[model samples]
Target chain A: MAVLQILEYPDPILKQLSKEVTNFNSSLETFLKDFIETLNSHKYCVGLAAPQTGNLQRIIGIDISRARKPHLNNGLLILINPKILEVSDFKIVREGCLSIPDFTANVKRAMHIVVAYQNAKGEAKILSTKDFEAHAIQHEIDHLDGVLFLDKISNPASDLFRRVRY
Target chain B: MNESKNYFAVFVLGTDSPGIVADISKALFELGANINDSSHTIIGNQFAMLLLISTEPVYNTETIQNAFQIVTQKRGLTVYTHQLRHEDVYRKSSEPGQLCVIHLYGADKPGIVYQVTSLLAKNSVNITDLSTRRFGSESKPIYIMYLEAEVPNNIDTRKLGSDLNKLALSLNVEIKYELEEVASL
Candidate 1:
């Protein structure tokens, strides 16, 4: 397993839509291991997407259990070509990203979501999540679509805040 | 000239009028003064502005003040300029804490701001930004206050909420507090 460098904002790769992960083989497994390793390298980072590491594939890693308040999390999650089937219970919450450091903004997201994805073994899996887990999943999915939290801010003047260094 | 000693805080206040920003900005631009940060807003019939500016050491507070003399005379504006201390040139970074917003509204009354802010200050809660607005008719005005603060993690927000509830009841107002959840991804 290797920890890959996370691409920061203004990187053209981050703005490109990730392609679907069609070949689920040893290469995919190796990439997944590196993805998990990269995520674990950061403190309090709950989720990550393939595009964040310059990989143009629809792969995301999420483990909200690492979050400060892991409300309704299901340990580690590896999703390939993930899609949101249903969503409800919308709420506005502040969000920050590794790609865009030192800034946080309020973004509206679904509190509950039903999603379908493929596992590392190429088997199809579906899950319904709520609260923090759901929020993390949604954020990672946005990365696959070349979207960032800054694009989702409702009011730039008031909702955006400068994050304090830890 | 000491390039490091060229920072100043400028304040401008005047009746609301067109071209105020354009005129002021043009004057500063001609003087090669860079506006590092500025906030301008209209309150009722008055336009208020606060600016942090930096220029070449050759330009002092008096130099910048003289540049605005034309606008001051033409627009009848009040202007103040003060050289900033080295320490004051940069804002202190905020401490790591949970960000929260407190919203309060009720019939207009005296001591509302004093009472609420005093309680917050006593509890060690740092107020980051706050604004109050008066609405409705003059005979029956309503006061609404929105405040953003950094709350220490050690403090129980539920307890703070309860205390605010009690304060609201005593003051005949409504108070709501919510933590600004920051999702890390």
Candidate 2:
């Protein structure tokens, strides 16, 4: 398994809408291996979308357990062709992206969400998540639709803060 | 004079009115200047703006000042320009640190800014941006301060919080702060 390069913003590919995953073939298996490796390579990185790695496929890897502070999560999640079935109330949370790397914005996201997705084996699964995990899920799902947190900021001048890289 | 662009720090202030930004930007654009960073806000009917502009090596601070002469005369705005050294352009810290946002509000009084900033300075906390406003009834004014700062890795955050609490008590103000966590997704 190898760590794939995360494409930063201004790269036209990052804005391209990711395609749905249809075939769970050997190539998909190989890509998943590299994707998981890349996700686990960074410290405190909880989630990564397929488009971030320049793969225009509807897939994301999330593991809030890897964060510095303890957060209630589903341990490690590899979601493919993920779809948000339902959502709850909105809350503001400061979010930063690996691709953007320069600024963090207070993005309004659903506090609770119901998601339907497929696993590595192409088996359908539904996950009901809340809090930080739900926020991560929404962020990753947006990547599949070519939407970045910058687009969802409540107030551009006030809510956006310069990111101090750690 | 060699080949690199010249950077200038430009400050503009005047009575708040429409067309301030349009006139200023048009001047800069005609001068072939690129605004690298800028922020403008209205404070109590006064329009204040700060801009970091870069021009070709041929232009200098004087050139920028001369370009704004029309706007200054027409709108009665005060404009100042100072050239900046190249080394100061990109001074990002090599070592990363924790980012913190501090919010403080209380009755209007002097020394509020001094007391809090002094405490932050003693702790090696670098203030990145700060804005303070006075509001509420004229008889009972309320002062609010919002600050964004970078805390060095060497500092103890827990102790800092307690210190701030003590300062809040002494100053008789409500102070709340949170360390910004960037969920790297």
Candidate 3:
């Protein structure tokens, strides 16, 4: 069991573009497991990326099960070398990143998204997500491309400060 | 510059214009005042500004209260100043759960905003953000109200939408629910 340290923003590692995982072997398997463990170790965190833990690879881990939330039905979805095929109508979302650590941004995302990627078994697969789940997938994908949620926000007037309410 | 000194909370309300923000900031700035944080908005014809500013209290609330009040009255703005305590500096814990915005617009009449907000109150929905205004003329008035609310987890969006749809028919108003992403800092 490996719990990787989350790298915060302004760290050059977080800005690095993640490379595609060409070889899905045993080493990749260990990385995926460690990513999931690290994600679960944090409080109220539902998703994580390879770059989040200082790895510059196109690997993302997601799990949206919330103990406090009732309507959410989400689980771990690992995407390696993922690509967004199409996006539905644009919808704005409030999102905070593990990379940025403190500030949250009003990110605009597609209501529905179709993504093509490789699964854990190295088999190519495609999936479609809508609403909150779609927003999550896009967020992780942005990390793989070195794009943070702050980059996607439209208006700074709506930007917020003070991480903790004071 | 009174960079490290006492903090004061000032409440100003009246007709809003471009110079209102600049004038107040200019006065405070020249007096070596540092604005810690502030949030103000214009609703209808009135602009309300609440500022948390810090400056060396030359004499507590009575110090600049008279001078600023005179200036405020001359500018046609109502002003109330207070010496901020430690308790007043921090905001209390806000309501939990997701914040959503509901917008309603249609023919204006009695009991539109009242009936809509009353239904929300009945459902234990708290409106954290609200801005309402009337457009058009006396003969054909149009009412528009935008409300940001905190919705508990137990409620389903589909049911809420359906209920709102039913209410729209009875009230003769159009309503839309936009799940505002409030968690975004």
Whole-structure CA lDDT of model 2: 0.89
Q: Candidate 3 residues B49-103, lDDT tens each? A: 8888877756466664654665587678888888877666754445455667788
Task: Extract clashing residue pairs from model 1.
Answer: none
- RMSD over all Cα atoms, model 2: 2.6
TM-score for candidate 3: 0.76
Worst 10 residues of 1 chain B by lDDT: B88-97
The parts of candidate 2 lying over 4 Å away from their true place are: A68-70, B1-3
Candidates' RMSD to native: 2.9, 2.6, 4.6
The local lDDT score (0 to 100) that residue B18 gets in candidate 2 is 94
After superposing candidate 1 on the true structure, give the runs of residues whose Cα lies further than 4 Å from its correct spot.
B1-9, B31-36, B52-60, B81-94
* Residue B147's lDDT in candidate 2: 95
Q: lDDT tens string, model 1, A12-125?
A: 898889999889888988888899999999988999999999999999999888876546789999999999999999998878899998678888889999999999988999
TM-scores for all candidates: the values are 0.89, 0.90, 0.76
Assess the local accuracy of residue B42 in candidate 1 as a C-alpha lDDT between 0 and 100.
94
| Candidate 3 segments exceeding 4 Å error | A8-16, A22-28, A65-74, A99-105, A120-123, A156-166, B1-9, B14-17, B27-37, B44-46, B53-76, B82-95, B154-167, B178-185
Worst 10 residues of 1 chain A by lDDT: A154-163
**Every model's DockQ, to 2 decimals?**
0.54, 0.55, 0.29
Worst 10 residues of 3 chain B by lDDT: B176-185
